[model samples]
Target chain A: MDRPVSEAQTKADLGETVLFKGAALKLDCGAALEDIEIAFRTYGQLNAEKTNAILICHALTMDQHAASENPLSGKPGWWIDLIGAGKIIDTDRYFVICSNVIGGCAGSTGPQSLKPDGSGPYGTDFPVLTIADMVRAQGLLIDHFGIDSLFCVLGGSMGGMQALEWAATHPERVFSAVPIAASTRHSSQNIAFHEVGRQAIIADPHFQGGRYYDGDERPRKGLGVARMAAHITYLSETTLQQKFGRNLQDREAVSYGFDADFQIESYLRHQGMTFVERFDANSYLYITRAMDYFDLAADHGGNLAAAFEGTKTRFCVMSFTSDWLFPTSESVQTVRALNAAGANVSFVEIESDKGHDAFLLDEPEMHATLDGFLKSAAQARGLNATKEAKDD
Target chain B: MIDPKASAHGNLASSRIDLQLIANRVEPGTKVLDIGCGNGALLDLLVSDRQVDARGLELSQKGVNACVTRGLSVVQGNADTDLSYYPDNGFDTVILSQTLQATQKPLEVLSEMARIGERLIVSIPNFGHWRVRLDLLLKGRMPITGSLAASWYETANIHLCTLRDFTDLVDQIGLQVESCITLSNGRAREISGKPSARHNLLAQQGVFVLSRG
Candidate 1:
């Protein structure tokens, strides 16, 4: 049997881990991890000037396989549509890098990574992380490539938070930043939802206080339940109604019991079960905690504008109309701060019914806006435009 | 004098009399905010020609998206309500090109423009123009002229004003007119002194450059 050509090409693009021996990553929580490692995948060639590099930060559940086949799932990458040859991100024109963030399970320095002393996986012992910490880890990886400044740093949700952090903390090194479906800080409601997920994970007997590494039975049920609860937040009520709508699953009538009777329930169960197979329970806890700890304004004396004061990085912030998790109002706050700081910023609230997940879905308005913004940024950065521009 | 380079722009031309008049008044390399910048035609001109850091606020989603497609910084917001988000003296010039009359709160919007911008450039269709006056008088009903083409009930220009009424509002808001030009048939000429009844009656539109008193 012959394999697909794209799969063969993507596997070639997939990169392994680059260990930074003796390099210390100082955390926001007063802890430092030395000899950290970053697993990243790259697409396209870096121009001679090294001026056409774009760093794509991944969301909470996304890994480094942004525009390739995931080695684990044997599935297409999350952003395969937006970041390929002649795509909106256009790998043919620029170098695109996506890395598994620190505290993530994907071959990076995380809860699953063994301790330096070789005792076991870090597990629950991983120091509490922040969005800034993840960005700091990424900065080391960029340094290894000898790239002084990224042409653009962009992402959605947690990835968006990192993009903003890169712009705020390392302003000189970022030429542009795009934060989609993100907020300056995680709201209380978001924290509450995360708490519910964490509680569900902790309640599981197999979790063994986050040290399920040695056991054959990892906390699959707990992680699955956590994913199920969190998945509901990613979509809007409208999308749930439209997609499933109290419809029965493989039957004409309700089961009248705790079985997956509704199509929505079955769908959620499948989502949770599949997610558990790929993601670690402890990594989820650390990553969500990091997101909750993110507050760009709090660190700047409660002045969000102070984060980008006198910065030159251009910004484009986007929000979905139906994304109540990170609502349009949050994007408005960010835009207002960018305005107050006298930064060059563009904002677009796209009409999306898919909720926060809209950024990951097929949104023509979002794609068009991003394409135009990137093209303009490329021109400003002096990156040569491709001969054949994708007609978006 | 009309800029020979102005013809290079795709949609922007000397034919957009109000926009050209507004664009000409803006200094190069200044921060500009264009309220109701439909499709960002004027902003595109200001950014390329003047090298100004231009931003826009448009009410229509279609208009905002179009502006973004051009890589111009524009936000979808209403002039009547969204002005408070901007900081004081945020822009060197804030333009309201032919959009003043369409605003729900013309006075508040003007005041907010003055608050946020060091200078405010406003243009409005002159309701006191001879064509509008003649149509209303002769027809004994609401006037419909070239500039005010929409029917009275259908028009978004709820706060229609003449050059004199606009000047009065500017004065009432404690804004001094730095320069004033009356436009008629794609032509613009500076008023020699304070806008009089003659200017109001003859001009189809008026563009005023104002500063806080």
Candidate 2:
């Protein structure tokens, strides 16, 4: 796929402007944000009816640039393979939209953004938020675009959580939803992992109670440790063995020292170090809390089925074989709940060794499955290939 | 004329159809459920040509979505565990094409498939074929080829069996074999033959049409 000439050039080529900005949503913690900003990018052209729109939510560390070059890291979006021309998503066929979520550090209103009280940053003082808050903010953005209903809301990981929220809350507004590698409720194990990461960040003296933006001496070490710990959960034991398998890093034998002697150790160190460069520590604290607080069943009168009661939106739930973070068992539970609710739902557990990250990687089985499903959905909507508008 | 508009983007090579065979068994406008409906070729054919009220239950989300995009009614659910949710005798025929072996509990699923539909169509690689037996005796290891493409450690066919084994299970479970068709790589073959150990590999595969006894 060819790169869009330039950001400004592509924006000019778009011929029309689609701004995504709105007012702040008041939090339950008795705090309010004003004049909130949302950064998003759109692909393909919306038809006259505007029913061809697809909303893609990003994962924990990902931003709104779904298929564009990231300004912060200068790297292409994490999901370029699945979101390009003629790809499984087929940006040429659907009007794809990806946005940075609320309570995110990446250009969205978050702890790092300016506070309503004219303070530099909200930091630890930022009001606590939830996944529903993020979804509510996304709803505002969708409304800003003048789109009534989304053709499909698709996402994985934390993005998948948002997709589920969109379907459960605004069932009438979404035609279909594809929630990949996610769970309806946060598992106790997941909550434990998030607590460990939070502790790692707070343990650093430089963290200064989450108000560490004053100096260059940020909580890099603590945040890096948090990233390393969380990264371990993102992979399966089988995948770890296949990729590292206790192999010594840069040496044949163990040195019996604190150095990264094992390949897995070195790999995790690299992942953690790289993550701190582009992420804010306070934002990590906020997002992890949001994820831990996610429990859809608890919110809807303790009935998981009632969360999606009486909605006609189609659902496709997918999970990876080796993803223990949100395993196939969790997905099956969700499917069972949906079945009990009598909602039209489909589920697939793709065999993969990539663990939780399978959704981001190039898995042929995943691609083939998604391509077939999306293409079928388009056809059902009466948008045949011959009738589909061309991208000049 | 096969309208290009009917064919959604991408060449559906994996979903080649034997329309004559399918049409002979299934009537026009009959309710059908295709298990493991690869790319939904059969359901698509039935819906477009015969105007059949076809619903599909596919394990692959991509496959289910493809069927949906083609405007065919389908749900994404595994035949192994999800089949029990369907009401008894929900469809006129439940088609399981080349996907029975990949299931964890082939016998249990087969029974479920039969219970949910009036009739069931099953296709499996003929392990009893002489070639498979020869390969087992000669090579001394599990075979890996196009149709069965997995090593011993990763093969999804945990419950592989021969044509005879399938018949024995059907008989044991009180299900009758309505119409059985043996095939050798898409070509028809005789089911009864001398126990040529090489027949396993040579026979390649077989398709059977079965119903409740």
Candidate 3:
């Protein structure tokens, strides 16, 4: 590891592995996992009333290193742009908490975490987790801090799924929820992409049936291919065509062999190779499965409105126009359900060519929308008037 | 003031006479849903001035952004399609301000509005104004006036109509006209003595509050 964050740096950046001892997490398939260590990072201090807490849920591959310095790459956190001292989220104002989900490999109790008895990694022995299970585990972490409710719960993609579930399962806890670039359920195309990635990992001989941790050989090729496929889903065709197009990687002519000739090919290969270094293969399988099975409506007796019936929590549902993975139509359907359920709701279909990953990138309109939404919500909750009086 | 943008003009009501009339009709502490609430000007007026609980549905992102910025609840959605999601009699008053002419199905939208609110508010630009008629007659082409500023080819106002036309539709739909507020050149017009024909010819805008008969 090039940049192993020092003890001082970890404390300074709120990087800590918090194990809620005897943290009992029950899976959707009637299985239970004990001793959950939820790696989380917090920015800003909880107010005296503890009402200014905002829980940020991360996407499929993202960990709890939100708005901090990433220990692995010596770079800023993935969502550093939006959650800084003076950024849209305004860490100076609200106590922001982000936790690595249960099925994650980054210091969380994932399929790759070492068994409690000091055996090898849990690997496939980890019970399958659902989005609700993940939310339930996150609730334990939030409860430990003595926060009765959060100011807001917000996320994009898989993170968005968690935000939706958080509001649905515990409507009283979240005053406002923002679910961006996500839907109530995963589309068939999403499942298809996930299935292809799983198959790629399974096809590798070195995978060793998800028990690759037993030997020195890891499923590098298989996991790399899987990442390559999954990364394409995160971006739009316009982005790829604009970034790479038919440009050659290094030469003027095609290689004519299996070697990468196009710049897109080389880019995907680099993305795949770099990803496998930090992420575990079995954890990827588990997380993907969790995302694939997330259908909020199906769980609520096939009535989407029933999931949010009589919900008093305010919602801001957003989607990018070019995000085909979770299109504008998906957000519209969600807004419809919220309206039918008489929920306080707002929606914005942002015009952008950045696709599903637009929520992570620099979207000025998105920032404005979020800033406006939160500011209004804060005022409604008396957060603004209180802080102003304090300053005065 | 440190920021002039944050200052509320003490007398928030602007020269939009129809808006003033609509604002005057709204009671305190009632629920209001303003469709196509641009920049949330009227909703903000209602919220801050009238103390009425206000919500909004705007079709454009910019509109929704402005509404949210002003601390008003506004969703981005269309009138023709998304109105069906709202439950019946959810709001005391549902206002469609100067947006009736632009709707794909104005009648259907108004019908949905009637169902969603106890009182339905609609403001339609008068296509039968004397200037519009004179311009059409003399120029031999589509007329573009101050209220209907865009060219016929480029305009988003697909179902433009006159005061008489709208009133006829209201009658056809079995709606009782509670009151009619007429405006001309951003000034309120008195319609008590004049006939409906004169109101249709002179008025540039008409704000109507209708109830299902």
* Two-chain DockQ for each candidate model: 0.58, 0.16, 0.54
Best by lDDT: 1
Candidate 1 per-residue lDDT over residues A1-392, each given as its tens digit? 11111111122333567778765678889988866878899899888888888999999999999998898889898999899988999989989999999999888889998989889989999999999999998888787777899999999999999999999999999999999999999999999999999989999999999988998988888889999999999999999999999899999888789999999999999999999989999999999999999999998999998998888898999999999999999998998888778788888999989999999999999999998889888888888888455586
In angstroms, how far off is A223's CA in candidate 2?
1.2
What tens digits encode model 3's per-residue C-alpha lDDT throughout B153-210? Answer: 7777789888888988888777888878788877775454222988899888788878
Q: Which scores higher on DockQ, 1 or 3?
A: 1
Whole-model lDDT values for every prediction: 0.86, 0.75, 0.83
Docking tier of model 1: it is medium
Per-candidate TM-scores read 0.93, 0.71, 0.91
State the lDDT of candidate 1 residue by residue for B1-213, as single tens digits: 012111112223435666777888999999999988877899988988798999988877777777888899888778898888788888999998878887789999999999999999887779999988888888898987766666777776788888999989888999999888998887789975358889989998788999885
How would you encode candidate 2's per-residue C-alpha lDDT over A1-392 as one tens digit per residue? 11111112123321222233334466645565566666677777677788888999998888877887877678887889988777777776778888787777777778887776687888998878888888877776677667899989999999888888899989989988889999988899999999999999999999999887877888988889999999998888888999999899999899989999999999999998999998889989988998889989998988887888776777778889889999988887777676556566666678888889899999876676676567666766666453345476
Q: Whole-model lDDT for model 3 versus the true structure?
A: 0.83
Once superposed on the true structure, which residue ranges of model 1 sit more than 4 Å away at CA?
Answer: A1-14, A387-392, B1-15
- Superposed Cα deviation of residue A308, candidate 2 (Å): 2.8
